[model samples]
Target chain A: MTTPEPDRLFTPPPLMTSPALTPPGLTPPPPTPPNGVPLPYQAAPPPTTGPSRAPVVALSALAAVFALVAGLFTALYLGERTDRDTIASTRADQERTLANVTGRQEQADATLETNRSRESTLTTQHDLLTQCVEAAKGYFALPPGQTPESSRLFRVMYDVCPQI
Target chain B: MTDHVLSIPSPPAPPRPRSRVAVVLLSLLVVLLLGASVLTIVLFVGAKEEHGLEVQRLDRTSRSLTDAEGRLAETEQTNDTVTDRIATLEAANAELHKCADPAKESIIAARSDDEEALRPAVRRAAENC
Candidate 1:
């Protein structure tokens, strides 16, 4: 009926008496494996990330190509727009200059025409003056204040003279 | 007799149609490229036309400028002619001013006895306008 001394000393280990050091207002973890209950905790296996290389590479390549093409189109569009603006500005200036020149040219032409007409008139007048001077050159004379016969001759000459 | 009815298996279901996303993306890219190209072309053509018109106008302006220069030169020549005519007129005016005064003086002196009596009338006649 007597038990071995080693069996008597092999008593179960003492249970933890200290309270868990959990923060205030937080629920403490359920008492781990109450007494001899089997543990439910286990390390999770490594996550199985599937193969994604091809699709990712394809999408990235597509995005890059699209961006490049779009950028090129934008650049071309900007260049053309700028070129048009510059050309239009230059043309506008030219048009304005042309308008001014046309006005000035018209004025000059009118002045020239007037000068020509005036000259023609002057030439005709000069010819008439010359005829009058020639007709009166030597014979033109005024008689003494009182002379009936001389007055008669002067009146006759005046009536007959073509250049007066 | 077991007849083996080897009916041609209906052609394997046509290969599944491509995903809508892939088709839509490709179509969008094509449409975008085409639209951009069209826009660029329109701009290019417009700019070219404006440039051509500008060139034509510039040429016309140059021709007009040349004509103006020639006209100006002709006007200068006309001005020279007018200046010569003016000089002629001035000479004529001077001659009128000199008036045959000495000849009139001789005639008056010869009529010395009547000089006093006819002085007013003769003086008036002798003075040129």
Candidate 2:
């Protein structure tokens, strides 16, 4: 097998003139004159009908509708967002108020507990004071010789009421 | 021999009027599509952010309310306890006064010099008052 010339190997085949050999949907090239010049008088392919306006118009209309709907939705969303933000802000304010109220409540509870403790202490002190008064009375009523300094009533008065 | 010359093809027919209209319509469609797309994206993003913030705020509010309720309940219980304690204290105070009054009078009436009477009175005051 002789190696073909490189130019011949790369050269494209002549256009197919046989209609049967042409690929489907492809028209065979028109025959050239013996002079090898193609005729320029060949009919121009019927002016390619520009795509019908109806489809593009309909598509444009649909797109316009989509754009309009989108615009409306955008407005609605904006309003919704504003309303939601307001609601969120209100809720935040409520949270702050609740926090303040809770803080106040805790303070009140602490104050109440302190007052209760103080009141209890005061009540206890009052009871002790009353006992001390009664003991002093008893001590003073005792006759001079019989009134021993070591007596329980004297001790009670001295412990609770040093002023006496 | 005559010279062979190739004739130049005429310029392609000007674009059809209908095709120009179609081009304009397609362009409009593109613009509308772009606008719709941008709007949709903005709406989606805004809604997402708002939803997240709203949810967080709602959660915080809910928690705050729960805390307030708990505090209120605690305060009420404390108030009731304090009120009951105060009532008890008052009653006890009244009882203390009841016991001390007559005893005080008796001690006051007794004479320091009267050893026999004073001794009994002092003993009764000490034991009961």
- Please report the candidate that would top DockQ against the real structure: 2
Query: Which stretches in model 2 have alpha-carbon errors above 4 Å?
Result: A1-93, A96-100, A103-107, A110-114, A126-150, A161-164, B1-15, B98-128
What is candidate 2's TM-score for chain A? 0.50
Report per-prediction Cα RMSD to one decimal.
15.5, 12.5
For residues B1-129, what per-residue lDDT tens digits would candidate 1 score against the true structure? 112122323334432344345555765766676666667667666766776676677677667666766766677677667767756755653453232232233234434655654465335434431
- Local distance difference test, candidate 1: 0.52
DockQ of each two-chain model? 0.07, 0.21
Model 1 lDDT tens row, A1-164: 23335445433324432245566676444333323333454444344343334544565566666666666666766776676677667667766766776676677667767766766665554554443333223223544464665455434324322221
The fnat of each candidate, in order, is 0.09, 0.25
Give the chain B TM-score for each candidate.
0.54, 0.64
Report the C-alpha displacement of residue B80, candidate 2, in angstroms.
2.4
Per-residue lDDT of A15 in model 1: 42
**Could you tell me how far off, in angstroms, the CA of residue B106 lies in candidate 1 after the best superposition?**
18
Lowest summed lDDT window (length 10), candidate 1 chain B: B1-10
